[model samples]
Target: DQQVKQNSPSLSVQEGRISILNCDYTNSMFDYFLWYKKYPAEGPTFLISISSIKDKNEDGRFTVFLNKSAKHLSLHIVPSQPGDSAVYFCAASGLGGGSEKLVFGKGTKLTVNP
Candidate 1:
């Protein structure tokens, strides 16, 4: 069974609009989240992150919100730009587990139209 899931496979948003990407986890032990953006040929690049202890974290135009009780997390990008169009993946890991490998969800492809 997949521990992490991005139910939506694709999302489209107009430039300058808000793009919200959602992820869900089945493992409560997951204490951290890493959102990565991948272009067509390059490796995934870190976008934003959040720890289970905090409900929200923001950086520039990107914000991440965690709802521990619901096992859900979301990444919001305001004023979405064309450069933001990519495959976004959600990876989760335990805060201090010796060997709990990172669990990644199937990415959601985001298309930002200018």
Candidate 2:
């Protein structure tokens, strides 16, 4: 079974509008969550992360929210710009028994239309 899932395959938003991406996971053992943005032919670059203890984390225009009880998470970009258009992936890792591995969602493609 897939532990991580991105329900939406794509999203389109107008420039200067808010862009929201959603993700869900089935693994309750996951303690750390991360969001990464990737461009074509390039590796994913880490964007934001949140520990299980924290409900939200923000940096500049990007924010990540975690709902541990629901096993869900979301990423929000306010006043999204053209450059923000890219494929975004949500990743989760658990620190159990001193072993940790990252499980990632397929990804959601965000399109910012000017």
**Cα shift from native, residue 96, model 2 (Å):** 7.2
lDDT of 2 by residue, 11-100 (tens): 999999999999999999888989999999999998998888889999999999999889999999998999999999998998842237
Local distance difference test, each candidate? 0.92, 0.93
Worst 10 contiguous positions by lDDT, candidate 2: 92-101
Q: Per-residue lDDT of 60-105 in model 1, one digit per residue for the tens?
A: 9999999999999999999899999999999999864323577899
lDDT of 1: 0.92
Where is model 1 poorest over a 10-residue stretch in terms of lDDT? 94-103
Off by over 4 Å in 2: 96-99
Candidate 1: list runs displaced more than 4 Å. 97-100
Best by TM-score: 2
